[model samples]
Target: MEEKSGDSLATVLVAGAANLTIALAKLVAGLIGGSAAMLSEAAHSAADTVTELLLLVSVRRSGKPPDERHPFGYGKAGFFWAMMAAVATLVGGAGFSVTHGVHEISHGEELGNLTPSYVVLAVSFVIEGVSLSKALSQLRAAAGRHRIRPLRLVRITSDTALKAVLFEDAAALVGLVIAAIGLLGSQWSGSALWDGAASVAIGLLLLVVALILIQSNLSLLIGQAAPRQVETGIRAVLLAQPEVEEVVELLTMMIGPGSIMVAAKIDFCDEAGAAGVEIACDEVDRRLRDRFPGVNLVFLDPTPTRRS
Candidate 1:
């Protein structure tokens, strides 16, 4: 779990640095080229930069060691801050881009030399790609460990920091292309309509990604259950114990990224004494922890089996 947290930290740092650089470059190019699409892209990068900063906070705060005051540690802080980052993307990135784009479309502005815009877009694309590759590398590493496809792991994974960086970097790459096309269209037709429309498209793109991120983070904050396969594996381990008669109920919750809590009610064999049950419980804890490293907390309750 600590290793996974470290991976997330490194991923977000790389992304944040790339976004900061791209945001400055886009801002400068937008001002010099007077391209509305470029300016909207600048806003998009700025919002991504902010998102990365918030993710940084989430990663750091969420890794704190559990204490008496908060026995579960500060894991959920990651989800909360990641959600805030999504909000930033929505308000700062999408809202600004759409409104500015609409304004430009309604009141067209003269465009200046677009050579700088083209150059910056190309450079930003390469840099954002680098950042995106870093996120993908981490995602693939995790998927490999779990023996699952990267795309499937991404959907079910609770690591919002990783998810946010991946999605935002992807969006950044697409937005750059859109901005470049807008620049060319305006230059070709000598009309701002193409550029303005491109800006709107970029805004809508950000909007979709932001909403998806927000929903993911919200679900985690609300204590989503661990994946079905995980629960099934856990139950199988419990039922395999020789002293156990049945597993009446098994519950699992994601306490944080790479952290899970499992609670189960088990019926013991009539022949097993209290001491045997105690030893069995201890063994169960050991086996589950051994099999599932993410199972940080486990609770076992002995219950009588119901008569048929």
Candidate 2:
């Protein structure tokens, strides 16, 4: 678990650093070039920098050891911070991009210096790609351990920190492309409308990504069930034991990133005594913890077999 948290922190830090660097560059270029799309991109990158900082806080706080006050540990703290970051992205990245674009459309100004805008965008793209690639590589390795694909890992993996960074960086890359297109189109046609439109497009893209991240974080905060495969595997592992007769119910929740809590009502064999049942329960816990990295806790409600 510590290792997982470490990896998440590392990913977030890489993205955060890259975003901060680009934010400053974009701010300068936008000011110098006076392009609406470039300015919107600058605001977008600045918002991303804050989101990364918040995600950094989430990863660090979530790694704190469990205490009496919060027995489950500070794991869910990441989810809360992730939620805050999503809101920030929506307001700072999306809201401003759209509103600024509309305002620029009517009051378009001549782009003063296209050279700085072009250079800054190119540099931002390469850096953002590097950061995004690192995150994806980590996700790919994790997906391998889970026997799933990278895309599925992004969707189903309980690591909220990685998920947030990956999605945000991807949106950033796309936004850059849109900004570049807008700049080029406006320069070609000698009208600021194209640049303004590009800003709107970037805003809409960020909005969609932010909403998705919000939903994911909200679900985690509200308590999401483990994946279907995990539940099935747990059920199978229990029933395979000789002392176990039937599994009445199995419930799983992601208490934190890669930390799962499993509770099940299990019926042991009819001849199994209390002592034997205890042994069975212990064995079940052992097997589950061994089989799944996420199965941090197991609660088996031992029930006698009812003769129907």
Candidate 3:
């Protein structure tokens, strides 16, 4: 878990640096070229920079050890901050781009020299691609550990910092391409209509990404269940114990990144005395922890089996 957090920190840092540089370049280019799409791309990079900063905080704060006030630890802090970062993207990136694009469409500006805009878009794409590669490297490694495809892991993984970076960087790359296309269209047609339309499209793209990240973080913050495979493996571990006759009910929650809490009602064998039950509980706890390090908390209640 510590290693995962460390990877997330490095990824966010790289992305933040790249975005800061790209934002300045895009802003300058937008002003020189007088392109709405280019200006919208600038806003996108600025919001991404803010998102990365928040994600850095999320990664660091969430890694703190369990404390007296927070026995479950600060893992969910990552989710909360990631959700805030998404809101930033929604407001700063999507809102600005959409509103400006619509205004530009109605009250268009005469096109200026677009050479700088094209050059900046090309350069920004390369930088965003590098940041995205870093995220994909981490994602692929994590997926390999879980023996799942990278795409699938991204959807279900509780590591919101990583997910945010991957999504934002990918969007940055796409937005750059859209900006370049808009610049070309406006240059060809001698109208800002295409650039305005592209800005709106870029805003819509960002809106979708932000909503996805927000939903994912909100779900995890609300104590979403651990993945199905994790729950199944935990149940198997419990039923493997000789004294446990039946698993009456099992409940699990994702208490933090790379952490899960499990509670179950178990029916013990008739011949197993209280002493045997106690021993079994100890063994079960040790086994579960050893088998699934993420399963940090476990509670077992012995109950009589109900028959129809």
Candidate 4:
């Protein structure tokens, strides 16, 4: 657990530093070049930097030991922080860029100084890609154990920190591309409207990405289900117990990333006496814990089956 926490903190620090540097550079370039696209990129980077910081804080706080006020530990605090980060990205970054883009379009100001804008954007893209690669590597390592593709794993994995970082970095890269295209269109055609249009496109892209992240985090917050395969595997393990004649009901929900709480009712064979049935249920619970390390809480209710 300590090793994992240290690794996560290191990842967030590296990514956050990259974002801060890129944001500063982009903001300067945007001001000097008067390119709407550059300004949008600046906004996006700034939001990313802030969100990364929030993620770092969340990770640290969530690692705290359980206290009287919060007996479950601070793990869920990470989810709430991640959700706020997504909202910040959408509102502070996307909202600002879209508003500025509209203003530029309305005022019809010609873009100026293309050279600086291009330089900053190219550098930003490289830096953002590096940061994204780190997050992706972590994600792949974590997801590989589950034997699922990275994209699908993001949907089901309990690691909100990884998900938030991946989405932000990916969006930043795409936003950079959009900004570049818009800047080039304005430069080639000598119409400033193209620059503003590009900013709008980048904003929209970020908005969509942020919304998806927000929805995913929210679902996890509300307690989502463990993957179907995991639940099935747990059921199989339980049924293998001789005392467990059959499983009548099984309920599993994710209490945190990669952690689940299970509630099940099992029926014993008709011939089994009360004492034997109790022993069977206990065996089933023990086996389930052995099979599914992620099952934090397991409750087994024994029921008698009708004689066939």
Candidate 5:
């Protein structure tokens, strides 16, 4: 848990720093170019920057030790802040972009020189790509550690901050292309409506990303199950142990990003005593935590089998 937590924090910090620079560059280009689409892009970048900051807060808060007020510790903090970041993206990025685009379209403002916008968009694309690469690299390392494929790992892991950075950077790259196209089209056709249309499209794109993130956060907050494969692996290990006879029930829940709580009911050998059971349970707990990075907490109940 310590190693994984540290890596996650590092990834989010890099993303946040990258977005900060991207946002400032876009803001300058938007003002100089006076294009609705470019201005919307600026707002979008700013929203992403804020999203990274919120993720950082979530990571920090969630790392706190368990307390009486919150018996399960501060794990859920990640989901709460992740949900807030999604909402911020919707309002700060999509809302302003669409509304401002509509206003500009209705009022028809002439777009000034687009050279600065073009230069900045190109630079932003490169920077965003770099950040996306960093996030992807970390995710890939995580997948490798778990011996799972990339897509499947992403589906099962509770790394909301990493997911946010990957998807947001992808969206940012796409939005930049759309903005550039809008500017070029408007310049060639001598109509500012193209720029407004592009801004609206960028807003719609942000809406889609925000909705996905919101749904993911809601599911995690509500408590999701671990992967089927993880459950199967655990059951196999328990059954293979010499002290165990049967695994009556196995349950698992994702209590936080990269954190799972596991419970099991087992029937041990007829001759095994209390001392033997304790040793077996401790061994199993250590094995599970070592083999599966997500299995941070495990509880075992050894009960006698009822005769028919």
Candidate 6:
């Protein structure tokens, strides 16, 4: 947990720094270049800065100890903030870009100062790449331990803040490249329409990525179940104990990244009466705790089979 928290904090910090730099640079470049694409990029970076800050707060809050008001802890706070960030990306970033793109297309104005705009885009791309590398390093370490792909880890892991930052940085890099291409094309062809079109494309790309983040965070907030393989392995471990005859039913839900709570019904063949069954259940719980350190909560109910 400590390692994950540190990684999450580092990722948010890097993202925030990158967005701050990119937003300011793009805003100046856009005004000087009179390019809609540059202005749209400025808005995108500004929104991302706000999102990264919110994610930082969410990560800190989620790490708090369980309180009387929150029995399951504040883990879901990260998910809620992540969802809001996605919405903000759609509204504040993509919305502005689309609107500006439409206005540029209708006005058909010529853009100026292409050289400084390209320079700013290049610098922004480099900064975004650095942020992306930090996020990927953390994600790769976690994913390797779980023996899963990075994309799959992002989809299922409790590290929604890291996931969000990584995605946004990646999208920002791609958007910068697209904007540069459009700028160059318009400069060579003497048509500002291509630049406006690029802004629209960037907006659409952000909208798609935002929707994905929103859906993923929603799933986490609604209580997604743990992977089937992990649950099966846990059941097998419980049944391996001598006091546990068989696991009748098992249900597992992820409460946080790398943390789960399990509720199970088990049958015991080592004892006959209710008192004996209670003892067996206690033993099973201890064994499970010893075997699966990631399981913070375990509720085992003993049920006697007809044969037993």
Best by TM-score: 1
Per residue, candidate 4 scores C-alpha lDDT tens digits across 1-308 of 00145556677887899999998998998988898888888998899888988888778776777779976667677778888888989998999889888887887577767898889888888988998898888877766766677777777776777778888888888898899998898889888788888888888988998899899878878877777878899889888877677888888877654567788878877677888877877777677777776676788887555643
Query: How much RMSD separates candidate 2 from the native structure?
Result: 1.4
What is the per-residue lDDT of model 6 for residues 57-152, given as tens digits with 9 covering 90 to 100? 878877887889888777778778888988989998899988898888888678888888989998888899999999999999988876778787
TM-score of each: 0.98, 0.97, 0.96, 0.90, 0.93, 0.92
Lowest lDDT block of 10, candidate 5: 1-10
lDDT of each: 0.91, 0.88, 0.91, 0.80, 0.86, 0.83
Worst 10 residues of 2 by lDDT: 1-10
Estimate, for each residue in 1-308, the C-alpha lDDT of model 2 and write its tens digit: 21288888889889989988898999899999898898889889889989989998888888788989998888788889989999999999999999999988889887778899999999999999999999988988888778877887788877888998899899999999999999999999989999999999999998999999999989988889988888899999999989899998889888878888999998888788889999999999999999997788899998655661
Better of 5 and 6 by TM-score: 5
- Candidate 4 lands at a TM-score of 0.90
Query: Residue 47: error of model 1 in Å?
Result: 0.6
Off by over 4 Å in 3: 1-3
Show the colliding residue pairs in model 3: none
lDDT-superior candidate, 3 or 4: 3
lDDT for residue 79 in candidate 4, whole number 0-100: 75
| Candidate 1 TM-score versus the reference | 0.98
Q: Which of candidates 1 and 5 is the stronger one according to lDDT?
A: 1
| Tens-digit lDDT track of model 1 for 44-155 | 9999999999999999888888999999988888889999999999999999999999988999888998888888999998999999999999999999888888998889
